[model samples]
Target: MSAYDAVLARQSWSKLTQEAPTREELLPLVAAAGRVADHSSLQPWRLIELRGDDRLRLGAAIAEANGDLKPSSKPLRASLLIAVVVSFRPSEKVPRWEQEAVASGVAHVLSLLLDEAGWGVIWRTGGHTRTAAVAAAHGLTENEELLGWLYVGGKPDGKRPGRRKPVDAESLLTRLPSAEGIAG
Candidate 1:
């Protein structure tokens, strides 16, 4: 399929099975996705793969932060959990927000790649993701922030493809109000 067609076909599926991509299979997909529009080449993003016990540990941290004593499986919904993190580097040329956007772009691209490779993937985030306990669990430094987790696994049989509201490209574009000589 064409690149655009692949992206349009990608969907976020929460109903995933334990079958998942190995590290070797996942590494190249992530590397390719890293080729994003990054200003100043700050490369401020990082990804952490959490599997098996690691997910349990993260769930424990999240549960503790939420005042719960027991770890829950809700955060460990998939066979693999990729934590998309953004580390802000002090840059006079680029703002922190822009750097974070680059990281977020990486996450989206990674999700698309996984979906194309027959993996069910979903980007999951909540208030707990940004909490100190959760950050510490992921070994996030003070300058680093956890954007969210990409839950990935095998898609169930006979599941329907994802659907989205068709967007009107024209409605999204706006022409600047005509000043006397502002035409471009």
Candidate 2:
């Protein structure tokens, strides 16, 4: 499919199955995702893929952080869980939020790449997800921040694609300098 076609076809699929790409298969897709529009070439993002029991451990940490005694496998339902982390580099040129924006862009691009590869993906985040406990669970240092988890798996045949509300593009788009100014 063309790049534009892939972008249009990409939809967040939460109702995924246990079928996922192996580490070997995922490496190339990840590398492509990393080729994003990074300002200053700081490369401020990192992904930690969690498979098998690691998901359960993360779920447990999430539960604990939320004051729950039992862990919820809700987040672990997917075959692979990737923790999208923003690693801060002490840069004089780039600000922290800008670095985080780059990291966020990388995650979004990765999700699109996964969609193109016929895998379902969703970026999930909540109060518990960004907590100190969860960060520590994922081995994030003080300089690193846990952005969210990208839940990935094969899309079930009958599963519905994520809801997309109609957006008015004209309302969101704007041309700088009014026609009156130009004519003046």
All candidates' lDDT scores?
Answer: 0.91, 0.89
Tell me how far candidate 1 lies from the true structure as C-alpha RMSD in angstroms: 2.4
- Writing each residue's lDDT as its tens digit, candidate 2 over 37-132 gives 888899998999999889888989888898899997876679799999999998999999999999999999899989988899999988776787
For each of the candidates, the C-alpha root-mean-square deviation to the true structure, in angstroms, is 2.4, 2.6
TM-score per candidate, in order? Answer: 0.94, 0.93
lDDT score at residue 113, model 1, on the 0-100 scale:
90
The residue-level lDDT of candidate 1 at 124 comes to 92
Q: Model 1, range 52-98, lDDT digits (tens) per residue? A: 89999998999988999898677668879999999899999999999
Best by lDDT: 1
Best prediction by TM-score: 1
Q: Candidate 1: where is the Cα deviation over 4 Å?
A: 180-184
Q: Whole-model lDDT, candidate 1?
A: 0.91
Q: Give me the runs in candidate 2 sitting further than 4 Å from their true place.
A: 177-184
Per-residue lDDT, model 1, residue 103, is 98
